[model samples]
Target: MKTLLMITGAALALAANPATAQDRSNDRAGDIQFKVLGTAVLPDGEIEQVNVDIVGLPANTQTAASDNYVPTIAVEYFVTHNFSVETIAGITQHDVDAVSGLPGAELVSDAQLIPATVTAKLHFDLGDSIKPYVGAGPTYFLWVSDKPGAATIPLGVTDTDLSDEFGVALQAGVDVALGDDGFGLTLDAKRYFIGTTARWFAGDVLAIETEHNIDPWVLSAGVSYRF
Candidate 1:
């Protein structure tokens, strides 16, 4: 077959060149972008409570949360070509289980949530390599460090207090380009209506209290760089 006709004549000589007929990897007007991600803390099972008293506890005691895989970073600035403003630095880890048909006594806890976000983006031109976006803001959830299980709760607790969350963030994204330099590949999705309020201690005496409403759904992808 003559080597498949010399690979079909080099794909018709690179499709007849001419800068590939437009598609310069879009994003104009003072651009500055960077992204590196791999995260998913999806939890939309509806968690809520504002207060609770513990003393042999048993009054609506229920808690179960698990899902973690983190390592993310984002930065985007394009204040013109359709407006942009993005900032997100992340950290997520959660695993709390204490629900035994009732009467809280099978405790197991862990948490590490450090999130900071400020977004305001709306970009769309759908041409030169595709780029679509939509965003919303305010996400501050930092109540890092917490672990208290006391050997699966035999009473005589130690310490645990995790509370600090101020949320409201919505987003949608797209950006694909792997050619004309400037590198790219991004696909994001976020929805955090946050929640946190939990306390447990025995050394200083303040047994337990609860209020958690972590409505989360944060999915992400990686690789993107443009200047």
Candidate 2:
């Protein structure tokens, strides 16, 4: 929570300064832009639907409520008057659950995910104030720290592994210039079609394996500086 506030404050400080709005030229080739992005992530996919993977266990497990919000930073460098390259980086920690209606039948699991992405962007010539852009690229997800819940220890589910994912990315956004100093506010939406393999443990050993599609849509809003 504190980190989110710090990001918001820094963006506001940069945006509120008069020196940031002095330049209004959006088509300046070779210009470099930096952004502090605040993202609200709603996780939806096949991977998130699975519950317990214990062998010979009763079915009817519900996996839900793992969505989260994340903050990130990005850099954009213009290659031509209307073309640019963009890179974004962020990390998230998800609290997951394996549950059923049977009394006291629940397990908690968590994972850490980091995404590194690069994209080629084409900006529309919409004068100096309204700049709309579209981009497509690739993303690599690094998954780590797949921790099994305490409750699972008694259930013979001892471990888990969430494999890294590779997928394509698509995005669209608009940047609205703030005053004349080149500070801007941006609204961006992106989607990633990432699929991965997961393995679960039973009897303190690897047992169940599943193929999962981690398709996630990311929507973000934030502040940027265009130089």
In model 1, the runs with Cα more than 4 Å from the true position are: 1-49, 53-111, 114-125, 133-144, 147-158, 161-171, 176-182, 185-189, 194-197, 204-206, 214-227
User: What C-alpha lDDT does candidate 2 achieve relative to the native structure?
Assistant: 0.70
Instruction: Mark the regions of model 2 whose C-alpha exceeds 4 Å error after superposition.
Output: 1-26, 45-54, 57-65, 98-108, 202-204
lDDT of 2 by residue, 1-227 (tens): 24433443454454456454325563488889999999876654333344445465445544432677889888999887566899998887765454353334334366778877898876663565887777778999898677765656676677877788788877778899999887999999877778766677875566656566566778899999989
Candidate 2 collision pairs? 20-181, 21-180, 21-181, 21-182, 22-180, 22-181
Clashes of each: 0, 6
Give the Å error, residue 149, model 1: 18
What is the Cα-based lDDT of residue 163 in candidate 1? Answer: 76
Mind sharing the TM-score for model 1?
0.32
